[model samples]
Target: MPTPRPRPSRRRLLLQAGAAAAVQVVVRPAAAQEPPALATLVAQFAGPQKVREGRVKLEIAQMVDNGNVVPMRVTVESPMTEADHVTEIAVFNEKNPQRDVARFQLGPRSGKADVATRIRLATSQQLVALARMNDGTVWSDSVDVIVITAACLETTTSS
Candidate 1:
């Protein structure tokens, strides 16, 4: 019959666990734990092209009693003709679970580049709206919204 191996001591087991944890701490990178910057998210959506400011308008309240349903309006200055028109409109939020809030597609036949809708805000944070033209030029606008009552976050606090 083969001989049985001796069980490891409690102190030896604890020392091995501590060494493993230290190795993990040394191997993991710090930046990987951080959330992506809002600008990075915007750039990802806009593609590799440069993004300009203007020709886009975003309207939302600076302060609100509730974030469950906040009114939002975005207008892009475009003639809405076959030669010149807004191609797409997208909304992004800083504090939401996801960076993108909504996106809308349009064309010259639409006759207008204005959109009105309601979006949920997690808390007090910034919201960015971007519009793309037929020629591939992009325009943007941003607004800060304060939510007295949060819609996405589990807890809320007012500043």
Candidate 2:
């Protein structure tokens, strides 16, 4: 008569599963924990459309003493006619708790695709300005600003 094989212990199976789970945690290394990257935010805003680097211009100070109200202007080169015009302009920040800073909607009667305003910065990071045309084409421009004093502070509480 052939001898019956012994079944693997439940303890051994649990250890194997634990080891596999640990490996996954080590490989990912806080990717899910960390905030979304700037590119991800841009992708979410642009939706599947490709963003190009042209037409839109972002003008802001390269360096600022305070981030409370940093001035900026976004301008796009387009003919404000029913045939062609800028539909929207958006500003995004890399370090802010909210990726979206502002969004302005316009139409052919808007005359020009220019917007100037002040924004608060949490820290020194890149700012991206985007323009969406009536044809669904997207244009972008980015600038890096150094902030001496941060206007926003992010705090995390562990419960």
Candidate 3:
């Protein structure tokens, strides 16, 4: 084998390191930004409505054994009449990469004010349910979930 090439000079190595660090600093913000929290998501959708409790029921396990798919159900007390039906139900996860899990739009034809679905939880956090009534009012409820094993990708940090 040919003689090993001489190691890079200290000055050149330091310059290369500085360049690499600068590139990382430039690229980090875009790749590391997270989505808005649950409360912010609700505010964005509802636009200044007072969120009231007790009118809606959010059924989710207090502790989820798996985070890939957690069962969730939401029910609202509403007459399924043309004038007062629950028109929409939105599910949000407070700690997920994306806050809004899903939104189901209903109408008088749905004949009920309830919905059930499975959602992905990023971590142990609160899940919120928002119900929009046919009469232009919104109601909400929230429940906490304890996640023993995280399912979502861990947030990457560069030091």
Candidate number that wins on TM-score, 1 or 2: 2
TM values, all candidates:
0.73, 0.74, 0.72
Q: Worst lDDT window (10 residues) for model 2? A: 27-36
Instruction: Output candidate 2 Cα RMSD.
Output: 16.0
**What local lDDT score does residue 32 receive in model 3, on the 0 to 100 scale?**
38
Give the C-alpha miss distance for residue 46 in model 1, angstroms.
1.6
Please report, as a residue range, the 10-residue window in candidate 3 with the lowest summed lDDT: 27-36
In candidate 2, stretches whose alpha carbon ends up further than 4 angstroms from where it belongs are 1-36, 156-159
TM-score for candidate 3, please give it: 0.72
lDDT of each: 0.86, 0.86, 0.79
Give the per-residue lDDT of model 1 (tens digit) for 88-129.
Answer: 999998888777888999999998999999999988778989
Best by TM-score: 2
What's the CA RMSD of model 1 in angstroms? 16.2
Encode model 2's per-residue lDDT on 96-148: one tens digit a residue.
77778899999999999999999989887788998999999999998877776
